[model samples]
Target: MKFDVAVVGASPAGLSAAASSARTDARTVLIDRDLTSVPNANTIFEGMASAACLNVEPFSIHQVRGMRLISPSGHSLEIDAGGHFLDRKGFYAHYLNSAADYGAEIIESEVRSVSRSADGMELFLSTGDVIDARIVIDAAGVDSQLASSLGIKTMRHPDDVAWAIEVDVRHPGIGEEDRFEYWVGSIAPGWKATFSPAGEDMATLGVFVRRHGRDVQRFLETFLKKFISRRAGSHPGLERMRILGTRRGGDPIAVLPGRIVDDGIMVTGGAAAQSGLAYSMRAGEICGDVAGRAALERDPSRERLSEYSRRWWRELGFEYILGRASLERLRSMSDDEIDRLFISLSGRNLLVPGGLWRKSANAAFQLTKAMPSMLPRFLLNLLRF
Candidate 1:
């Protein structure tokens, strides 16, 4: 088969890339192992949903008003951040349908490898078929075969990738909660234990452990026990809380790959360490639009495709830097320090309603007042960008 742009993986990034490319009148194809597979449930902020043009109302299972951050010592801070818990299957289906509507072809086959062809690029599929394309976008999650084939290192270190284990369960106490809960500090080590309610009687409990040696199950078990006891006020209903399903994967949180675009290929999503859903989708759109124009102009060189990289870095680079720095600072702190910090900021609204700069400034002010010692290090981290 031949195409102007070929996107590997059916993740949000790939779907948006295919759709965006096709919208530009490019012949786009999206390939994946299983196009119908349901993804793990996730939350997205309202601003991101707007940026991605996603209709959250139709697919949202729960409307979130804020987040509760619980320190290891049980100190809590609430931040008003509007978002929604989406039904993953419905959300994926919506994107899939939209991509098709935009005239992008869908292939239910795994891409075994991608190689540069004389004219463009060739995708060798598991089905023994080859696809030729002027440009290729790799969005195959963290363990990306295409990125590996091209020698692009998306994760800088083991600690940059978080092993996550999550499960959906039915519990009486988890009913249509407006806030997502995060238990931070030693329990989950480099990350946090999360409780995201998906409306009536259903919620997901998960733990993301960084630099963990494939023993995330243990962390999940520990988190479950603590979460149940804390939320239900007892362990009496623990046995009755039926687990519906489990999902496990690697989430690239801290570092992104040094390179995302090459001679005729670009990488996005987890493959490029673009972790968040909205962020990945936006990256995909930028990548696809650039690739589509480059392909149409018959110039798929790295120099031409670098526009995607430049645009992405301009739009989302600050946010990624800020988030990574914050995570690093949190990882450096002890449970007692986190508890004290949370206590200091307990009643304050951290999510100031304004632009990113204003909100970041407000957060910096509040955090400096709470933990004056951290200001120098945090400022140093930001300056590195």
Candidate 2:
């Protein structure tokens, strides 16, 4: 089959890319290994969902008012951030249907390999069929087959990838909670333990640990015990908390790939180390619009397709850099240091007004004031990028 644009993977990124490309009048196709599997549950800010043009209300299971940040020593801070917990199966179905409505062909086939063709690019599918396209967008997750076949390096630091495990549980106390909870510091080294309640008696508990190998199950077990005890007193009946399901995956938090765009191809989403649901969706849209136009213009050259990279870097690059630096700094600090830092800033509100830069600056100032020792390292980390 031949097309103007072909997107690999049916992730949020791939679906968005296909829809955007087709919307631009380009003949677009989206291929995935399996369309029946449910997507992992995730939470995103309401603004982010809107910005990505996703009508999340239909699939939303719970409305989130804010987040409670818990320190290692039990100190806590509340931040007001509006968002929602979505039912993944319904959400993906909605997105998939929307992509089809935009005239993008959806294919349930694995792309075994990708190679350069005289005209543009060729996708070798597991079904013994080949697809030819003027431009290709790789939105496959961390294990992107298309990227690997093309000899492209998609992760800057593989070891920095966060290994995570989450489980859905039915607990009596979770139904009334409106705020997401995050437990930071040594509880889950290099990342955090998260409690995201989806509905009354339905919630997910997960832990993300970087450089911790594959023993994340142990971390989850330990965290579950501690969390249950803390929330339900001494007689917290662990037997009553029914675990419905489990999911595991790698999160490329600080390992952003260096090159995402090349001749006749562009990479977005987890494959390119672009984490975050809304962020990846937005990136896919930008990539699709650029690649679609380039395909129609018959100019899929690296120079011509570099516009996607330029636009993405101009828009979300700073936020990514800042977040990476902050995460790296957090990873370097001891549990005690984090606890002390949280204690010092316990009563201070972090939801300040202004753009990302100003808010970040204000946060830095607040951190420096609370713990003067972190200022030098924080400044150095920010300056390193």
Candidate 3:
């Protein structure tokens, strides 16, 4: 098979790229395993909201408006109350359909390797089919084969890949009043636990721990049961409670591997390491859009299409830096120390950090604003290097 551009991974980024490519007048072929198993795959999540944020709609950013940040011991803080809860599967389907509507052909095959030819790049798939394209885009998610085939290392560290097991919770007590709560603890210290509505009587529940170490299943069982039991206190019954389905997987956050392009090759999406809160979906859209244009223009070098990196940087580079640093700090922090630190920052409407020393600057401003009385805990946290 031959095309103008070929994309691997049929998920968010791949689908969006296909749509964008076709819209830009390129003959795009998208390859991936199978979408039928997504709902059951460890990756597809339930209770993941489908509502897009109204204010950010124009920008195509995906995130819940409000997130309830809870301390491991059960303290809570809410932020971005205006973000949308995403229906991840629905969103994926919406884009996949759009790509077809826009004229991209969907090829349900797994890519095995990339060999550049005189005319274009030759992609060898698992089924022994050879696909030649003017440009091959790697939009595959965390488990990106195309990115690695081109010698891009995907794993930054063992801890960069977050591991988790989620169950479709049928607990009666989890309700609208529950809000979207993210609980921080040893099981998932860097991030928070999320419990959002799955249906009238249930919610989707999951936990994430550092990619480094944890008995993932044991931790999930222990914490989930405890959470359900505590929240279900005084409820009519626990006998009927059950987990509808189980999902377990990891998503690694890291920079793109090596070069994003070589020969007739180009990369995009998470494969290009464009996963973050504000830029995740936008990465796909931008990648697809750019890849299509590059194919149409027949310019596949790092020089002509180097704009992909810039696009993501504009949307996420700085904020992602803070998140990355915070994630690192969480990994190295003692649980007790972290508990105390969160307690201090909770509920404070201080300025959000804007740069590398963002944390320090914000802390200083907070100290100045609340002087004399002295925020002892906050001061102690600020003191910690």
What C-alpha lDDT do the candidate models reach, one value each? Answer: 0.84, 0.85, 0.61
Using alpha carbons, what is the TM-score of model 3? 0.79
**Cα RMSD, each candidate:** 1.6, 1.7, 5.6
Worst 10 residues of 2 by lDDT: 230-239
Give the clash count for each candidate: 0, 1, 12
* Model 2 stretches astray by more than 4 angstroms: 50-55, 234-236
Instruction: Give the alpha carbon lDDT tens digit for every residue of 1-385 in model 1.
Output: 9999999999888888999999999899999998877756487778777756666778887889988888987877887878898889888999999999999999999888888889999999999999999999998888777877777665555356888899999877574788888888976544788888888888888998887665688888888777766766533576569999999988877766568898999999888888888888888899889988999999999999999999988888788889888888888788888888998887776877767788889999999998898899888766765
Would you give me the overall lDDT of model 3?
Answer: 0.61
lDDT per residue, candidate 3, 1-385, as tens digits? 9899998877666776788788998998988878653522212111121211112233222333456766666666665444434555655566678889999998887777888788778988889999989888787765567757666554334345666677776756543343566676654433445566543566667776554454577667666666756566655575467777877755445332335655566666555555542345556677777778887888877666667767756655554554555455445556675566666666676545244356547755654454423345434533332
Best-first order by lDDT = 2, 1, 3
Tell me the lDDT of model 2 at 307: 96
Against the true structure, whose TM-score is highest? 1
- Stretches of candidate 3 off by over 4 Å are 39-65, 187-192, 213-215, 234-240, 253-259, 276-278, 350-385
TM-score of each: 0.96, 0.95, 0.79
Comparison by lDDT, 1 against 2, better one:
2
